[model samples]
Target: MGRNTRKRRTPLAAKVVAGAAALAVGGGGLVWANFHASAHEEGPAHHRTRSAAAQVATIDCPDVGQQLSGVPDRARGEVDGELATMDSQITEAYQRLATTRRAQAGDPRFVQNTILGPLKDRRKAIIDRIQLEIDRAGGRADDNLDQLAGCQGRPAEQPQNGDGQNGDGQDGGGQDDGQNQDGGQNQDDNGNGAAGPVADDFIDINDVEPNSRDSENGLAANGDGGSTGTFTTDCGVNENNLFNSDNLIAAPGVDNGAHHVHDYVGNQDNDAFSSDEDLANADTSCRNQGDRSTYYWPVLRLQDGTEEFDANELGGGAEGNVGRILKPAQAELKFVGNQQGDVVAMPKFLRIITGDAKSFTNGDANANSSWSCTGFEDRQVTDKYPLCPEGSQVVRTSNFQSCWDGQNIDSANHRDHMAFVQEDGGCPNGFQAIPQLQVRLVYDIPTPTVENGQVRNPYAVDSFPEQLHKPITDHNDFINVMDEDLMNEVVDCINSGEDCQ
Candidate 1:
């Protein structure tokens, strides 16, 4: 799209967008424009500034391939061989990715991530050294950067037959049955590829590097510390069943027809059809004692097989959530309370905001909402698909208000009823103070791999069914389902500043 394609934004937003765009190019490369901070209430139509400053993502050749450091001559053949393999794999994977018809068949990105993506990583490991050697030789390797990164031709430019599956660059004669025969990577519902996945099937932890910043005596920095009392929950194993065609979250009187599927945890019976009355009575899957809060979000599909979704209809990359890559599956939560003698139980049925469910990008919208790696709360990024550290959990933390207007459980904007804690993290006077809920969804997903150390295509909220799910702009609903007695205990725990699990 041309630069003119973007409608202008407010002055402040535009400035922030431009700066982020430049930064993305110089540091973390992003597409044409990057998301900047915006009001959570602002909708997606008003998202992303179409600034040219956003650099087309750049490829980062992997460093330390076999050797600690070396020049171009020693590894030219090895690099070339690797690149050829990548080209072939990219072509093959692209074909299957584009053609796979069923959602159960898996999204094309599944093939890219598992199959061809590894080739990109492998190629990077060797080429990084060659590029470094060239740089060390005093002549810049800028000219060769794209080529060495295993680009079929140029950066962001892959060999394309154009008619390939899911916009994959391959065409006729390249299509596959979407059967990932290598092993049990992302398998179909029928369990065709039932074997354990190969290394290529997982995200390359190295590609999405984690922020190792430690704060205060080597403990990972936390957004909410002992500076405030907290109410943490022991959200146990992922108990939600496989999301089938029936787990619909439609609005009142609405049907799940246009909506796509979403994996649900928390209250098993919770759905879009759920009401405050229905939720209050629903039992929960929480491992904690007497706490029956509900939590759910869009399910991330492995994209290994075909699903009931049709590719020819409103699915796929351009239309529906069809070709969308998914988030790792998991959710964790806690409630951060004030130091006030005793924090009161949050009113029942209070719908809270944590990370902006509408803030799809990691940039501007990330001022208050975004995903972060464990132990690094201060260094959150707006990249919807931020790679978490290997052996660590992918944490999505949502912070709710400690002070409520006391009259409304919900507001016209769904935000007016509550307010942020004071700069000192204290509740304001007049507004009835309640337990500040902090939901942390930690998925046990491996670090997703990146070819050329760049995120080529990031998923968004619209990638899923519209009626129910929103992409990375994730915000969850919670209806206090605790028994009256359990609620009192929670309030007592918070008010007394006692740590309760």
Candidate 2:
């Protein structure tokens, strides 16, 4: 039987306030809280408080790989290998998050932006592979891990493509579609630089879990299976925009900080850097939607000189020593929730990020997150990229959690204020759970064209800038700019067991 047990999490001893410094063992230095309150999200940062009275922030994960025996016949060996890799990565991701929480006791936003968000994104590949292999083996894995991995049942299954050319790439996309395709071609041979890695269009979301089988009627999975309901929207024509250099935040002063732009979506006039007020007041392409939440992330390229993404140094690469950055295509932001209870309006300034910018930096090679052909989302062999069947385009699917600690909307780590939705689709006790939001991005990227020339990763996720046109570096963020009324509507919809557009 596959089951998980929650450990007794101890509460915090007391709350800390901003500017009121505390002491450390044998150390006497002020605990700095470097937070600037945004107009809409004004309040003391979570670093100055805790989720509850004396409750230390903690994340729990079940013992993975413990149910390998459940893996069926033919796929057993592959499933076992993938599960082991998955279990190790899952453990590291969670342990790393826990360690981060422990280390950055004062700043919760740092924990959220720095730990929780990145952990979820980095774990995407493992989660997908596990699901695929488990299904191939004819078994079900731990539901919690599946959800946490943000693994949706998948778009719909596809027959194995590419003649099985995974990584042994002696042939990625084996179709030579790299050289030609039906208008949706995503290759770069202009000579400025070679095209990046090639990927498939999609993997069946239904193969791993069936939508009809969702535990609750209105509740949809938060990517993976769960008792949560979900809906997505494109902020009208304002779906994509360029960032203002003045507001830029990542990749410190490079090229006199003149370039290195990012692609944005959500609020209009959003720049590289900005405050909650600027984001809220600015116009949005999200026409009718009353809730004025702002969402944006880095943009990818098509490398054919058509799309933007022309920055000299993309948003990441903090560790340096790399030629190209890896990324995924598309970043969808939507509201999802419990079928029975409505999610309380998220606090005005709840800042959230879903992936780490510096994730592929230095030695932190992302194990499996990357772009690929349709029906081959789980394959990791970089070079053996699969070729999609006709009518399919490459895409990246990302998800973000929606539960928040009632008292603290903004934590030092950004995550302390929020937690993953529980297996029951409810927020944890005392924590204010909001509707889970999911981000799904689709790209026009065709098959890989620039074979050995500029291709860097043969076993990696989508890399960036150099390979911008290749649909790499997919990430997302959001700030709850909704006032009381609109938020209440969101809550009402969820509590009533309904579907939202």
Candidate 3:
């Protein structure tokens, strides 16, 4: 039903080194182990060594899409199409890298010559086309796009966020020896399909320390002008099973723009080719007909060797994303008011993308989603997947950017049109506060067994194959389509400090 599973090596003796450096992967505070110590050593010494080159785990390429913020409106479509092609090129190159492990072991430069070299050449040509497209459309393109064409293999042990502290509000070096360094189970370098989601990517939720931080940036100075109202929308958790690999906001008109499957709720019509008119007139999964907005995010999967539809297709098993998909048990969509002042109505057809889909390599500048257990939500993580204890479920929460530029509905990079509330809980200059969208999803998953430095039946979120299915890469997308009357009603309700649905 899915791609052929690769053989996993028996884990070596798991050593407990107390307080080694833990790298925080994102701003959400999930610390990961950056130690290069080998697991196969029989030493009382605190450190072990493995071939650094052999630990090349995934591809690390610059995010070209995020950098093309100046693309002209007339050239956006073609440029976006080219960018999607670049993604496919990387996926194919990663597949080659995964299948050629034996060849790589035999020749040191096998990867550089046989994989990355060709990939860079292809990317360079695409960049040239993009530049020419912009030039023809009377816009100046960056002359140094070639710098973004070359990519290097990301080592498995690199530090996330380049910080020594974990994001869960604890010093990385303070964990007990019995605790997992990366806040997960033991270490097993081998991954499914020779790609990632290695055992170190998971952490016991109870192991994380409890800390409280403002989920939406900094706190307000005063509450005199704040809007304290709330609104709830009844959108079922994708019970209709609408799934696709397309992304209308980022890579419109290109199939499989996401390179991963997304669970869609709200608007029934959403795909690469769905137009704004099509969405406004389409059926919706939301109980309120006036709120025809669309919301979606990547689906989570259990690595339990079960096959479903699209198992062999692109963006699924073909792209190293295998296993049975897990549906969310509960989907809570709430719109809350700003902390410093009243929120205005969101413009119709406004698009927002919260979190970075490529944060595994692009760094955590835009990584905003957080993971936790049902009862332990006070402690949230961004990099490591939470291993929930019994009687608790896995939870993923996304709090969207609530500030709108009050001008364009969309931007070239798809992010400039929106901003997060400032630390003072007010919008930036020229921007106004809008109803902040908060998406909370809960999943009842069978916990994976991590024993003897190995994991079985581990669950992971869908990601680009080269991104290694890291939890830091989790993201969410939204489109506002509420009718004007309903939108105004929402604004009034929030301004009046009333909780209305």
lDDT of each: 0.38, 0.37, 0.71
TM-score for each of the candidates: 0.48, 0.46, 0.82
Q: Tens digits of per-residue lDDT for model 1 on 1-501?
A: 000111222223223322322211111111111111111122332111111111111111221221222234444333333332332233233223322323313443443444345545655664565465566655345444434333211111122222112312112222224442222222221111111011222242335445533221112112344325555776554443523212122222222221334444455455535566766666666776477666544444332222323222222211223322344455556665654334556666666544432231111222243466665555444334455565666565555556777776654234556676665445567676677666566555445444432222222332222111122345444556677776777777766556787
Give the candidate number with the greatest TM-score.
3
lDDT of 3 by residue, 376-398 (tens): 98888878899999999999988
Candidate 2 structure quality by residue, lDDT tens digits, 433-452? 67766655555444333233
- The predictions' CA RMSDs to the true structure, in order, are 21.3, 21.1, 11.2
Q: After superposition, how far is residue 497 of candidate 2 from its true place, in Å?
A: 1.5
Worst 10 residues of 3 by lDDT: 13-22
Total colliding residue pairs, candidate 3: 5
